[model samples]
Target: MVQNPETIQECIEKARQRLYQIANQYPDLWHPEVIRQSMVLDELINEYNQATRLKKTIKI
Candidate 1:
């Protein structure tokens, strides 16, 4: 139901912030919690990219 790039951007920002928090909380870069949050941030970014790309293609 969410086709808005603005909404996706907000989600990406939130995920990025959360990843930073988790990374700071865990000193080890390889910690499970840190890795999980990093993956989540990556997914949100990828989703945002895909959403934007789709919109561009549709406009063309």
Candidate 2:
């Protein structure tokens, strides 16, 4: 079965939106900690994607 890129992109966007909503809910307590962790996680995800791209390019 073939998957659509647009559908996958939509799913990723929705997940990001949900994460943002959850992060915004702790307005009274630990807000800074939560935001900092979220930023780290986002950075890690970017790094992982870059590594994956490098691996694919190396294989070609």
Candidate 3:
């Protein structure tokens, strides 16, 4: 699946917001699920950026 940069950015931002909310709700414990989701979001953002760069390089 392919995602545009803007969409990827939006998703990343949403994930970050959710992470913050989770942290606020559970100040004592670290939730593995939330952390994992954030990590996945980061990976997706990185992948999107790399794909965009590759596309630009190919066009050059």
Most accurate candidate by TM-score: 1
lDDT of 3 by residue, 1-60 (tens): 767777787878887787777777767445786677668778977877887887788889
Show the lowest summed lDDT stretch of 10 residues, model 2: 1-10
In the range 1-60, model 2's lDDT, one tens digit per residue, is 223444444555655675677677866436775666566557545655666566678789
- The candidate with the higher lDDT, 2 or 3, is 3
Q: Count the backbone clashes (under 3 Å) in each candidate.
A: 0, 0, 0
Better of 1 and 2 by lDDT: 1
Residues 1-60 of candidate 1 have per-residue lDDT tens digits of 435788989988898898889889998999999999889888888888888898899899
Query: Model 3 TM-score?
Result: 0.67
Q: For candidate 1, what's the RMSD?
A: 1.3
Lowest summed lDDT across 10 adjacent residues in model 3 is found at 28-37
Model 1 segments more than 4 A misplaced:
none
Q: Once superposed on the true structure, which residue ranges of model 2 sit more than 4 Å away at CA?
A: 1-30
